[model samples]
Target: MPAAPLSILHVVRQFLPNRGGLEDFVANLAREQARLGHRVRVLTLDRLFSAPEMRLPARETLEGIDIERIPFFGSHRYPVAPSVFRHLGDADLVHVHAIDFFFDAFALARPIHRRPMVATTHGGFFHTNAHSRLKKLWFDGPTRMSVRAYEAIVACSDSDARLFQAIAPGTITVIQNGVDLDKFAGAAAPEPRRALLTIGRFARNKRLDRLLATMQALNAEGPDWRLRIVGVPSDITAAALTAEIDRMGLSGAVTLHTGLDAPAVRALIGQSSLFVSASEYEGFGIALIEALSAGLVPVAHPNDAFAWLKERHPLITLADFADADAAAGAIRGAYDRLARGEVTRGEDLSDYRWSGVAARYIAVYKAALAEAGHGVAATAA
Candidate 1:
């Protein structure tokens, strides 16, 4: 006899189309799990994640998974819906994304219900600057309370796991963010030339200014490279930084596109000679891996979670943390070095495919269930 598949309810803060990384990860995981014969559903916040835009229906079915978007509130940055607990009664497991942001749901979900609840802490405000001292204090207080609710914690990278443990101090599972290889199959890298690319929200932590500075430095040496910055930009940050471009005389060298779909974003990355990241920190470098799978070399400051991949693959370049300028200089130097048959592109990326990733997640799911005192039958095991 075969064992029955577990019914899962996944909770996320929001799921807008243009949101990167976590949105895609959650969507893929939900869809793939359904395809693998598991019952899956999604519950997210109702409000639009960004500026006035078409929102998905408040309640709908997507690829056989039930999706319910509800209105909940804590702050402009983090929202929650208490109604999630009502629907969770039917699920064998409850998976939550960005634990710190959606703590309200955890409070609504009582341990007396006995369903295994796993929380993945995607981001925290510890690294962000609060507008006031009171806001900073309030943020940390809520975060600590949230971390105490989870039966298990998941961190997408080793750095995130270590960081989570430092604050929460408990067992944390580290999982690498995975990409859908098939979606990038037809996308091809353009002829290698003086072109570079990067994507992210235009915030201080993203350090888009550093990438622009790198381009200015490279053009100063006469490589005449062009950079395309594809991402949503915060109005305040954009207003503050636009003058810097004119000051550097890089008006023609840099372009910023506000939003794009997944295919469009991957196509843009595919055509570039290299993918660059100047982030001060990252939970996981999803775009870096996407660019690498699309056959573009990745250059960034060393991130501990990515160290394993870098050691095994020569396709990535690392910059010194103290000076992003040196990192930019090295990337330009890598472009020069490419002509000697040193750079590789369009490498078969089946290894990073979501199917492989789904298998790993299933293993974690089973392990989590076991830890919570659920015994899956031997056949399923």
Candidate 2:
């Protein structure tokens, strides 16, 4: 007959009520696994550094999956919770989300309770600021060490797979993040007024300054376009972004939205004509995919993560990351084409839905378990 259910443990830095692409991915994956008759649980830090006010329960069941939050103590930015090791023996399989985090290192260092261990390298080690020698040394060292600890490593994009291969060099699988297509269901109708949308936290790596400059150049062309940014801002970057907007006299043209739920974000995208991003890097552009599903033409900086996508979707317009003026020109050109009705919607993204994504991960999980000599029959216990 039928194989039994497998017990899976997912480890991440934070969980629901803490908004981000990674958190969403983990939550969705766990929900799908539970729906497929597998026992799934999420383990994360109890405290959220960025949004301390939005505290979550230490133990709770969310969307049919169990979540356990371990109390942590340290600097708000990098809290450490050694107690996760005690719960390591509770699952048949362990999947850690990011390698750069403290919990990943702790999980990798300790015994895995004789279970198959897998790690999904969301961005790999490339997100670190190479300019800081100490930071580079600290992250890079642990990253390489952690890479060797997993039986299989999942990369969200081909670009990320290459980065992980450079370190550990084996059993890396490329499984792009999934998008809930139904949530963004709508026709590709451009708004009467030109509106560009981008979403992410205000981090230096996101390069929001470049996005502002691009908006400045676009506004100078006399079209009077509007740029909508949705994200929580860091203190320093928020001040810098606001000052730059006023200095460029774009206070009326640009809007910053914070604390938007998923439905609100989809509604914002549905109302926009174009989705734009100036991020220097991305493991997999989850927001971009969501925008594409919503039929918004994408205008983004060139990055290795999206190289495969650029080849498949001609509607995507990529601008050189080094030049803001050229990037702005590209965005304006795309907008002009949209205005002229040259392009209406993005390519069909039915393949990247959550059900298919969950199935792919299940296959990878089975392969990892089989390779470790724990066949499906054995894991069913």
Candidate 3:
């Protein structure tokens, strides 16, 4: 006799229409969970942080997963959406994405919902150095207290594992993020060019200015390398980025892009030689995975997450983007190696496949359910 399917509920601050690693992670995991014969539903805020003025439908279904959006009140830093309680009726397991309000709220309401809960720490709130003292207090106090409610904590990177492990010992399981390989698979040029690509939110920590400065230094050395920055606006506006480009005398070599469909972005990736990022922090480097999938070499800042990635894949090179000359030299080194055909493009990311990642999460879900005394099958049925 077959076991009954599990009903999984994903509680995230944002979803699909807002593009990012966390959104992609939830979307892929939910889709894979649904595909594996489990019922999956996503509950997110109605507003997109990048496009606050826009409103999404209250409820909808996509890729076989039901999605429900609740209105949030506080700032994006910690949007409060207690209305999620009304939607948890049929869920056997509640999987929270990131360590924000939902993580804490659902933890407090666990007794009411009577559902097992697990959380994926998508690089937590310390991305930037804004208010370090208070952030530490909140993490050591509220976050430490809140995480106790979770049956398991899925850390996306080794760096994240270290952080969460300190507060919640023996609770973390590191599962790296997955890439939508179909989006840019084999989209790179046959012969790499002297162009670069960077994609993500135009947040302050992305350090786009440092990338532009690196481009300036690289150009001064010779080859006339070009840069294409593609992303949506967040804390940093497009106007500000454009001004920085003009100010650095890179108006000619650097290009700024805000909105582009997948095809358009893929086209830019095809035209570019390599993908690069100067982000000061990342919970996990999703862009690097996407770049490797697209057959492009990645030059990134040696943040804890990127450093962790570098150890896994040799084609990924770490550079100090803060020092323009040094970063430029590293980029040149990558170009030389690519030209020599010494390093090939692409990494067999079977381990990062959504099916595998979803399986890992499913184990956590089953453990959580069993811990709560739910007589559910622990198998991946």
**Poorly placed runs, candidate 3 (over 4 Å):** 221-223
- lDDT of each candidate versus the true structure: 0.69, 0.76, 0.86
Best by TM-score: 3
Winner on lDDT (1 vs 3)? 3
Off by over 4 Å in 1: 52-56, 62-65, 127-145, 167-170, 185-190, 234-248, 306-309, 321-325, 346-351, 373-381
Error of 2 at 17 (Å): 0.6
Query: What's the lDDT for candidate 3?
Result: 0.86
Which residue ranges in model 2 land beyond 4 Å of their true spot?
A: 53-55, 75-78, 102-108, 128-140, 187-192, 234-240, 377-381
Q: RMSD, each candidate, Å?
A: 3.5, 2.9, 1.7
Q: Estimate each model's TM-score.
A: 0.84, 0.90, 0.96
Q: For candidate 1, which ten residues in a row score worst on lDDT? A: 372-381
Displacement of residue 24 (Cα, Å) in model 3 is 0.8
Ranking by TM-score: 3, 2, 1
